[model samples]
Target: MSDLGNTFMRRFVQFINTADEKLGEELIAPNAEFYVPFQSEPLVGPRGWLKAVEVMRGGFPDVQWTLEELVVEGEKIAARYTMRGTHEGTFFGVPATGKKIAIQTMNFYAMANGKIVGERGQPDLLGLMQQIGAVPAPS
Candidate 1:
């Protein structure tokens, strides 16, 4: 189970980095639930997940996520990632500032039948916003 979880998380990281719809469909269950920040409703399935990726890419065309660490147990996997990108387009109603950002993100996933069935993610949005000049950083 640990090996499977590890392999699944690797593929999941690939999907995130590439935003490949085909790969996403293969890794994510059709009815998977994703609990994300800011949004009130859970994003459902591969399409929903891909949409989120698209939004990120729209704002940061050179965005990339590196899987820094992973811990797997049974059907659960916890991952830590470093997300880096340049803000080159509008995001969350804020105009681009051509600033670079690197933020840490943590996510917990539940897998079934070798596919991701659920995910809860926590990303450093406040830091990201500050880096991109969307929000003021504290002195």
Candidate 2:
């Protein structure tokens, strides 16, 4: 199961880096749920996951996530990543600053039958905003 989880996560990273819908569909279950920050409703399925990726790409077209660490237990996996990109476009209503950003993110995934069925993610959004000059940094 650990090996399967690792392989699944590797493919997931590839899907996110490329934003390939077909690969996403193959990796994620049809009824998968993703709970994201600041959103009341959970995003569902591959399309929903891709929409989130699109939102990130809207700000950082070259954004990429690197899996730094992974831990698997039963049907669940916890992953830590370093997300890097340039602020080349609008993001969350904030204008582009042409700055580069590298932030950490932690995500947990639940898988069943070799497909991801659920995910809960925590990203360093405040750090990203600060790096992009959208928010003030602490003294």
Local accuracy by lDDT, each model = 0.90, 0.93
Worst 10 residues of 2 by lDDT: 1-10
TM-score of each: 0.95, 0.97
User: lDDT of model 1 at residue 79?
Assistant: 94
TM-score of 2: 0.97
| lDDT of each residue in 1-139, candidate 1, tens digit only | 7777677778888899888899999999999999889688999999989878888888999999988999998788899999999999998988988999999999999989888899999999999999998789999
Clashes of each: 0, 0
lDDT of 2 at 43: 94
TM-score of 1: 0.95
Instruction: Encode model 2's per-residue lDDT on 5-73: one tens digit a residue.
Output: 788899999999999999999999999999988588999999989988999999999999999999999
